[model samples]
Target: MANIQWFPGHMAKALRQLRENLKVIDIVFELVDARIPEASRNPELNDAVGTKPTLLILEKSDLADPRATSAWLRYYRQHNQAAIAVDVNDRKLTGDLTKAAREVLKEQRARAAEKGIQSETVRAVVAGIPNVGKSTLLNRLVNKKVAVTGDRPGVTKKQQWLKAGKDLQLLDTPGVLWPKFEDQLVGQKLALTGAIKDSLFAKDDVALYAIKWLRKQDQLTALVDRYHVTTEDLSLSDVDLLLAITQRLGFKDDYERASERLIFDLRKGKLGRLTFELPEDSEATDNA
Candidate 1:
């Protein structure tokens, strides 16, 4: 999985365009999956968006563990990074983001006000890796289906501008992923979160990774309940455990199909709201 290279040609072009358009962007709305915030972030963005204000949107908050989400919010606040957890269905989504962007650019807004320039409009670019819900966020902000949306990655392939009420003029860009993942675990996390295309990696590998991690956390209750697997079954090896669950799921010997189903259930929150990484697991937290 670490050797997976998913940098499409259009993504490279989008990065170039994002850099070229950064001068006019007032704030960057860096969206990341709430379940894998650190893994979902595009590291190249910081260099491209130097000195610009940024508000991190933890998209799909409703689908992640609430306690873990709260901890991540606190972690970002401690690092002086402005972040907010959001679900596309939240009524206050627009207002909350507008306020956060204004707060991040408060000094700039104040400076503009002193010069007798009054403008409520904020120019922000929505950015993150694919399938992190950029299109859904855009449609919700504008209150219209201006961008194509899907459950898979790479839905929005081009850049376009859309408006949200009276204050936000959003630049919606295609999801950008770095050329290569330096950490094997980061790649696996992305795969498990659906940030990477399902075809790019083996479904069974991701499923086994999820099972091992969840079992360690004792977070496999939902899986057991859904599949009717016993506590003794949980003590089995990862491969044996997956096979047992596969048999219970009535897939016969087709563990591959069972693997795909398991991955789907994990992503859809059928198993439960789970967080793949914590602040303590981050090297950045150590450095900070």
Candidate 2:
């Protein structure tokens, strides 16, 4: 009941499924967007049914700022949070989370033996906000792209489970946009990453955010070089930078064109692997 925003009907269904299944699951391998971990998680996930141990998988690590991801890993683990960074689309990159998850299970199995309930494999529910790469991660773990992959938000739309390994069961779900959506930066980050529908955001505003982030990363030269533009006074605001991009990218509708290109660059790594919101912005209003 937090002031969260953005839950879709399919997501409401997925949440019901998670609620029913939580009683049976051992732990949660929550797939958080590496680029926006704080924003990607749902408060309800922590408040699920029972107090459950969770292994936080910062998905799409390859596309996130390595330093920020590392710092986040340290921050979470320091608080005794089980976490790992991973490129959900690549198995080789996913090994760390798989291994880390198993380690947690192994410890749990040992402890369970003392309680006369020898739990061998771990049943973990993979939860995250819509479009946080849940399907991509599930496919890598199972060595197949079983779940549907798409560019827009709310792709999974339901609950599905897979036999990932000998001692691990992975569940891919489409539950994320909770009711409130309180923080502005969190919502903006979600929108930037495609967790929210494009129609919900002003493309010009979203595009401006991308431009500001890219400009700060010093990757404006790439955009400028690609479109033959000059960055004479690079100290412009987000809107001005986006206008420059519009002029360079040559999209008939300047705003629409710049927005598309900006999103494309981020998705394709042309703008550099960057994170939109920092930990400092966690308390801000939900901008989406």
Candidate 3:
């Protein structure tokens, strides 16, 4: 697998801004892709926000496997972290996010009361990697289009503050990725989920990685059902399987197009609900 690396100048500036503003922010609303929560998390940001209250918002829950999401939520809760799975388009997102913020700030609120100060509003900064739906979540929370949102990464170039409600003020920051990925699988997972720009890596390489990973999860049935391919097709090598899938879809000579389409389908949830990594798998990797 190719080692993917992307740390643009804007990301460096964003990290500096985050560190500078950390002291003023009451909590960090860290948005991560539900499909690859571990890979989507920015370790540099986490270290910068050390000891600050954080609420992990697993955005795009609709695109992830429900069972895997549940397990992750349980895992986070056990580790004493406040995490919630949510889809930005859901009607209840506003209330759910508000409740989560307050829950994370409960002790701070109590301390303020003890000091004869009463403030209902909680100041939070939303930090995450590119294209992890931070802008979408912010827009949904504010119930209007306050942030520039797109399907691709690097949509938000700077920081902007918006009022979410009477008790919540959110600072929407540009997504920042770390300088390097220690795990090659992390890079592959990020690329597979569109958190990283597609132009950084070959579509066919990413498609092959996705194919092999999905096969390991025994989740290739979605691809088979969607493409009308047989189980025998799954037995082929990653590259050959993609070629076969493309041939079946009448793109016999356009394997590149087929690979791109397959990746697009996975990103748009056309293939099915799938998650790239699970807590158990990460835990095992850590142990290894």
Candidate 4:
């Protein structure tokens, strides 16, 4: 497998602009995919965000393991990080957003009240890496298609504030990716989950990675059942298992096509509700 790195010129400009505009921002809604929470995060946001109040939203919770999501939320709270897991399509999305924002900005809101300043609306910026569902969440909160959305990365190209209900204003920015990936496994995880462009990495490489990861987690049953492969087949090496599944799917020796199909199914939740990283796998535990 080759090194996976994608940092377009526009992403660099977006980070610089994000820093410049942080002063007017009341809160930052940092979104990450629930399935690959750690890998989908843009580390550069820490420095750019500075001391801004932030609500860590785990988007696409509907597609992630419920148990893992709850555990991750617990981990965040234990670390004093304000966070919430949400499905963008939920009717209570705006309500949840308002509640989480209020909690995170409790002290600030109290200070304003002490000064006799009554601010009704919260001004927040939705920031995250490519295709982590920033635009989709904004549209859901605002109750309209304010930003163009797609299944792939880099769908958002610019920034603007959209009115989300009566009490919230959301500033949506382009998905920002860093210049390099120090840990290539992080890159592979991102690539497999549709954060990075598929053009940057081979489908077979990501598919093999997914197979090995699933096996390690004891979650390979879904794939085996979906593809109708045998337990004897599971005993094979990762690459051999992929090839065998490819043959079972009638792809013959075309492992790349089978790899693409496998990746697509995984992203669409065809395999099952899967979370790429567990709480125990976090860097703070020295196991990541």
TM-score of 2: 0.87
lDDT of each: 0.89, 0.73, 0.90, 0.91
Off by over 4 Å in 2: 1-5, 89-95, 105-107, 215-222, 280-288
Model 4 CA RMSD to the hidden true structure, in angstroms? 1.2
Where does candidate 1 stray beyond 4 Å?
Answer: 283-288
Clashes of 1: 0
Of candidates 2 and 1, the better by TM-score: 1
The window of 10 residues in a row where model 1 has the poorest summed lDDT is 1-10
Q: Which stretch of 10 consecutive residues in model 2 shows the poorest summed lDDT?
A: 279-288
Tens digit per residue, CA lDDT, model 1, 79-144: 899999998998998998999899999998899899999888999999999999999999999999
Tell me, by lDDT, which candidate is best.
4
Q: Please list the residue runs of candidate 4 whose C-alpha ends up more than 4 Å from where it truly belongs after superposition.
A: 283-288
How far is 217's C-alpha from truth in model 4 (Å)?
A: 1.0
What ordering of candidates by lDDT runs from best to worst?
A: 4, 3, 1, 2
Each model's total of backbone clashes: 0, 13, 0, 0
- lDDT pick, better of 2 and 4: 4
The residue-level lDDT of candidate 4 at 275 comes to 92
RMSD values, in order shown? 1.5, 3.8, 1.2, 1.2
Tens-place lDDT digits, model 3, residues 1-288: 568999999999999999999888899999999999988999999998989999999999999999999999998998899999998778988778889889998988899999999987889999999999998888888999999999889999999889987778999999899999998788888888998898897788889989998889988888788998889988888888898899999997798899889999999999989999999987897789
List candidate 3 stretches off by more than 4 Å: none
Candidate 1 vs candidate 4: the TM-score winner is 4
Candidate 2 vs candidate 3, lDDT winner: 3
Point to the candidate with the largest TM-score. 4
User: What value of lDDT does candidate 1 attain over all alpha carbons?
Assistant: 0.89
